[model samples]
Target: MNIARPLLALLVSATLLPDAVAGSFSFGLWGDMPYEKNNDAQTTAAVIRSIDRSDVAFSIFDGDIKDGSSACTDEVFSRTAKTFNAMKAPMVYVPGDNEWTDCHRKNNGGWNNLERLDTLRKLMFADGRSFGRRKLTLEHQDAPFVENTRFHKGGIVFSQVNVAGSNNNRVLDEKECSTKSARSAADCEADNAEYAARNAAVNRWIEESFAQARQRKAKGLVLTLQADPGFDLPETEELDEAKTRGWNRPESGYKDLMDTVIRETRAFDGQVLFVHGDTHVFKLDKPLHAPLDLLPNFTRLQTFGSPNNHWVHVTVNTRRPEVFTVRPVMIKAD
Candidate 1:
């Protein structure tokens, strides 16, 4: 009888062990790179060298591989891809406004934005896999919509959507278009329609990520985008100033996307990390609609970019409740 009791206790202990007690791995996150105003070439090279030296599972460049003021040349995409491939870790990239959305600007060579977007897809992501000597298995949404990508590693689900800054390419006033581009009112009208459709696609992709996370029972979800998605801005006065520009008050563009994201985060059992790069600073904070009051498990990570010229180092551990611990790695911090 005593031997039977000991056998039963052993079975119970074996069944109670937690989900493979999580392992840890680090990865890199950086973007809004090669800005013309900064010490671009020198800084970008240094940042690349630094990442190569570090031990990382993979690296994600959040977007804006070229400066907004530069030409949306095919060469830029190829060159950046080469730089990304040089990293020892796999590289994942999100799309940015400067590369496609704002390519219609006269300074950007007066190119049709959609045409430029097509070029970007062809040159940068045509392979349907990430850049690097070795590639990660990514589930892509595909083709014209190649920017939306998802992958899972170390019990964490990672994804990216093409929500860039510059009001997310939502506004297409003909006058503004005429000033920056030789395109017609008809073309601007088409651009507006494209904006609407893409925004809808982004909204759907945002919701899908959450559903996929739940299905996988992932320990953490990381949704990376290129837009800042303004949060915690000063209310009333300063907010009014910020809101005047569609870029600062993208809630108008992101209302439905944010609504679903917030709803899903509340239902998810693990931590959520919302990452972006347009703001060009290294910021880590709880920017949920109510933070401590609601969605307590969510965190926002804004990567270093432009003048700052640094990258983020994220340590992901399945055993930790937070799932991800992030820190900025300033390659040449002053």
Candidate 2:
């Protein structure tokens, strides 16, 4: 009896021992969900299904809601939004170049690109403030509109800037602009005023959000956008032409915003993950910059879209304060 009792006690001691360790949170990241002729509805459904099946806390679509030339029709926009809304977990969207930047095309609304941008602002960013429900809002009136949107489960800080690929100038066609009467000019002026106000609001939000993150001592930051700041290397002839026409890099305003974020976030002691689309290629590169010189713990992730649609999965663990892992999930269209 004594031997059996002692054995049972030993087993209980081993089983009841505490295994204390920090937990991790997983998130899904996708880019360039072009809801145009190229990306079939069935494929889009499959991607959504995959997201639904996964255990990620949330999903992020980097940008490019449709092809640049696709009409920004209500039906198209609604369908795309509906598909995305089908995901099991909530989704956060960052506008890409194709959504508004290239809406100046003849096939698109043919309206003032800036005005169309306003439409996007109303639709996707309805709150006129935060991204999702993170209580982050723009707080500056300068270049980079400061906005805060965070995923609490992952303990990640999300900041967005309203930077477009075409130098933030979605120029209306000559004929389109000229055809409008004087009355239309008044309307355009009003639209411009509203746009300016929103831009300033976003800038303010960004500054305040960064400051807040620092104050709270956040563990990591995730910055999502459509354009790649580093696109078009060497500034060669091809690069220059592409940049000029909005085919390659984004506008100067976007570049300036990226620089500002990179510079400001460097002060903190945490990982910074830069997620973007626009090039329609899935890439992961560790940009070489002085540690603490730029955004500390910065990792650049660009997921593929359109023909090679894919997604990214990131895991954050507090146990290992030194490193955070980002894993890419490539959902190829079958």
User: How high is the CA lDDT of each candidate model?
Assistant: 0.80, 0.59
Q: Pick the candidate with the highest lDDT.
A: 1
Task: Find the 10 residues in a row with the least total lDDT in model 2.
Answer: 139-148
Which portions of model 2 show Cα errors greater than 4 Å?
Answer: 1-23, 127-151, 170-202, 235-251, 288-296
Worst 10 residues of 1 by lDDT: 242-251
After TM-score superposition, what is the CA distance of residue 162 in candidate 2 from its true location, in Å? Answer: 2.8
Maximum-TM-score candidate: 1
TM per candidate: 0.87, 0.72
In model 2, what lDDT does residue 68 have? 71
Residue ranges of candidate 1 with Cα displaced over 4 Å: 1-21, 235-251
Write model 2 residue lDDT over 96-174, tens digit each, in one string: 7677656655566564565566576556655433332233333222422322243333345666555555444322344
Superposed on all Cα atoms, the candidates' RMSDs to the truth, in angstroms, are 5.5, 6.7
Q: How many residue pairs clash in all the candidates, one count each? A: 0, 15
